[model samples]
Target: MKKTYVLDTNVLLQDPQAIFTFDEHEVVIPAIVLEEVDSKKRNMDELGRNARETSRIIDRFREAGELYKGVPLPNGGKFRIELNHRSFSKLEEIFLERTNDNRILAVALNLHLEAKKENKEVVLVSKDILMRVKADALGLKAEDFLNERAVQEDSIYDGFQEWEVGEEQLNEFYREGRLQIPEDKKKMVYPNEFIVMKNSINPSQSALGIVRSNQQVIEKCWYQEENAWGISPRNAQQIMAFELLFRQDIQLITMVGKAGTGKTLLALATGLMQVEDLGLYKKMLVARPIVPLGNDIGYLPGEKEEKLKPWMQPIYDNLEFLFDVKKSEDLDKILSGIGSIQVEALTYIRGRSIPEQLIFIDEAQNLTKHEVKTILTRVGEGSKVILLGDPQQIDHPYLDEFNNGLIHVVEKFKDYSLSGHVKLLKGERSSLAQLSADLL
Candidate 1:
């Protein structure tokens, strides 16, 4: 049966093109939602850009016909501006306040009452968890906007799989430097994905390999036999991470792990080796989004680099360890002396062509899908981008574990040979830190 979808303001703000996603269904935009979107249109951020785009989409649709009534959408759905269902009589007794959320709920509630008379379904769509709960309490159908999610929470690809094989086959693989997987197993693997071949009889005996684009063969992993800028892989996952981080053919890589899994450190180490040691790239640029506790960087005092010192401190710590700068001012002298190494905020990354650079975007889990797309589009020819983040630690209000930019790119680019990802398990920071990451 066909149903009506009532989208909340947050949904449009997250994705401006959401109107065309629903196929052959009725899409209603409440007047209150328009009011909320208009209020956010002046702010200069992703939300503001989305708000402006949403208004422009609505206005462009208005040229077709009267939007207050109904207009034909290209996706075979009808779009309308809900004007009559703003009454608050039913919600005032329980919700008590006439806030924006309550007003949006009132519109949905009134629509539900009308739809019940016709024996049709009216669903309220939102990204806010509390809004869905409140809608359920009011006996109205509610759902989360899931078009942005590439995979379910449990079904997310972690880029590592274990295959059980006989000891002879494992030995043959080690001898020949390649192994042909079973047909059933080959169907489940992706290009550039890491595979751990474990002995069927002896679980302790295992060999690590990576799946090539063919998906039927597992090739030997490119482990860091030599130290990468004084840092070596401590575990199997880090070993897999090193291959993806250092490979020149793979232009895009993503590493997901806990807080202390050395994701950032490994990325910095590999970047330094390639940019400074081998001179494969002309420069090394590290950038991260400014989203965390407390105020933004504008509230702080000093020059651009001085203002970024607090956010870029972790990058400096990794550099300090890699460079073996014993003196307090040693790292500073190296940074000032080296022209190839650069660090900056992700806010200024827009509208520039970054060429011949090794780019690392740390704490990338804080970025949204559009933000990630913007940053990636800025990469010019002969540039590599590495996104490192812990999905468990997210600070963005609109993003979560499954929908953030880091996991989004990981899932979308898994099939292509140009991108590779690995989710680090064992934390190599310290015993206490590992325990806290697991327990907390």
Candidate 2:
């Protein structure tokens, strides 16, 4: 049976075209949602962009007929906007104030009554847990907006296991620098599971193995360096990050970190080494969202690149520090080498197929799942895409730790044979940097 879904304001703000996601199911937009959108239209940011886009979408439907009555959508659903005051008949006595949250709840309560009268299942979908609670108090069927949130975080496995192996097994693996187990041995491993082989007799020798398949031990490397780029992978959790970044087979890598984890430096250096030394990829492409962390770049003047100069400066600083170049012009020449390195913005990334290249997306925590999908689908053969950002320091206000696309991809891909992850523990920046991170 086709169900009716009443969308909350936060749902639309999270994704402007969320209505198109529900196939063949009737989508209802309350009038309060429009008012909220209008209020956000003047503001600048992702929310503002979504608000304007939502307005355009609603106006297109208005061409067919009034929003009060349902209009047919391109995909197989009907879209309608509700503005009736009678929706609050039951709750007006208690919620007489015109507060935005109360008004939205009123619209949802009204929809629930109408759906009951017509004997149709009506559910109000929202990202706001409080809104869902309010609907439940009013005796309405309500649920969370699943399109933006993760399935569950409690069950997120780290893709590794610990076991004890015989002394003979350890010597065999060390001599060969790899281990191949029987088909029955596969039962003990997950897709990307890592095994730490501790000597059954000596109790000292141990080796980490990343299970690529039934018998194959995926390529593994060990870094004796205490920390690289102000980050250290110490425990099993940190080891995952090191294994993923050093592997040549797993071409695409995405890492989510807080401020001082050194994600950007690691990604940049890996891209450089891959493109320049290893000859694995043809070129290195570095790009970011151009989203301001604290201040806007609009006040700056000149052409597009000039306007972006301030925002892109941090990336250039990383490159300059990596290459040990002091002059700005010298660094530009290095980047211009037969297009060895291309620093770009997301605006030009669309509609371009990237092949034989290493692409690094810094600050990926701000991107939505749909946007991340678009970027990943554009990757051509022999290309690697690395997304590096911190889930805690997300510049986008709407994106939380679990809900961001970077985390979602990491969680979803942990079970895949081709994917691996690491959470950096020790910060190598400096004593001051580490202390600041802890305090601030």
Candidate 3:
């Protein structure tokens, strides 16, 4: 049945095109939401950009028809600005504060009351957890906006699938370096998705390889060497990641894992291998989103590079381990001397064309879908981009494990031959680190 979905401000900020996603349902944007969007339209960050985008989108819809009354959406739904329900008829006693959230709640409550007379349903959609809770307390149906979420509980894509096969088929895969997938099993796998063919009888027997060309064939893993730049794959998942990273054909690779899972280290090693060792690219461009954990220390007083030093320390630590640099000055000297390999700050990475480079984006879970799109769109010809992050460690208030950019890329590009993803398990940083990742 068709229902009314009143959008919260954060929902539109998280995804500017959110209005069109409520297929065949009423999409109501509270007048307060417009005010909130207007206030953010002039800032210099992604939120500002989204605010402007939302404004333009709503304005374009206005050109078709009056938004105050209701405009017909292409998805066979109604879109409108709820200017009439701004009164505090429902929330006067409960949520006395006239804050934006309460105002939105009041609007949704008024709409819900009105809809009941017509036997309709009104749902308030928000990205904010507390807002949803309060809306529920106010006796309004609430939902989290799910249009941009890439991962679902219990069904997160791990980039690999296990297929039970006959012993003969498994042996054939190992012998011929490839196995032809039967028509019945082909639909289970996507292109470039890794498949583990285990003997149906022998649970101990398995051959790991990647699906290719519409899951018609499974090719053997690509990496022949044991180590890249003195770093070896600690387990099978890392090996799979190495295969994807080393493959020149796979231009985009996403590595998602926990804290000590070595996602960043592996990307850096492969990037160095391709850029410095093999000269496959002109430069190795390493970067990460500058998301601070816990309480922020405010701004630092220094030049751009100095200011970025703390935020990029984790990247440096991995690089130091890879290079065996004992002194910070020595590391700096080495980085400066090797002009071909550079650690870039994501803050300055915008609007720049990066060509013929091996790109590694760490802490990518903090990025929004739009931010990820912007970064990936900047990748020029002859470049390979690796996005590495743990979705569980997202620091952005508006992002979660389900909706962050890394997982978004992993889910969106899995079917494409140009992209490959591996969710690395078994952290190899140390026993203590692994324990902390698992327990703490």
Per-candidate Cα lDDT values, in order, are 0.89, 0.74, 0.86
Off by over 4 Å in 2: 1-5, 13-28, 34-81, 86-100, 109-124, 129-143, 155-159, 164-168, 181-193, 199-204, 213-243, 292-299, 325-339, 411-419, 431-440
Instruction: Give all TM-scores, in the order shown.
Output: 0.95, 0.73, 0.91
Could you say which candidate leads in lDDT?
A: 1
lDDT of 2 by residue, 271-370 (tens): 6766776788888888787652213555778876677777678798888888789998898788777478877777566699999888888888877775
Best by TM-score: 1
What C-alpha root-mean-square deviation, in Å, does candidate 1 show against the real structure? 2.2
Steric clash count of candidate 1? 0
Candidate 3 ranges with C-alpha deviation above 4 Å: 61-67, 84-89, 151-154, 292-299
lDDT of 3 by residue, 190-288 (tens): 788888778899989988899886679999997845588999887879888889999989999988899998898888887888888889999988877
lDDT at residue 87 of model 1 (Cα atoms)? 57
Stronger candidate by TM-score (2 vs 3): 3
Instruction: Please give the distance, in angstroms, between residue 203's alpha carbon in candidate 3 and its true position after superposition.
Output: 3.1
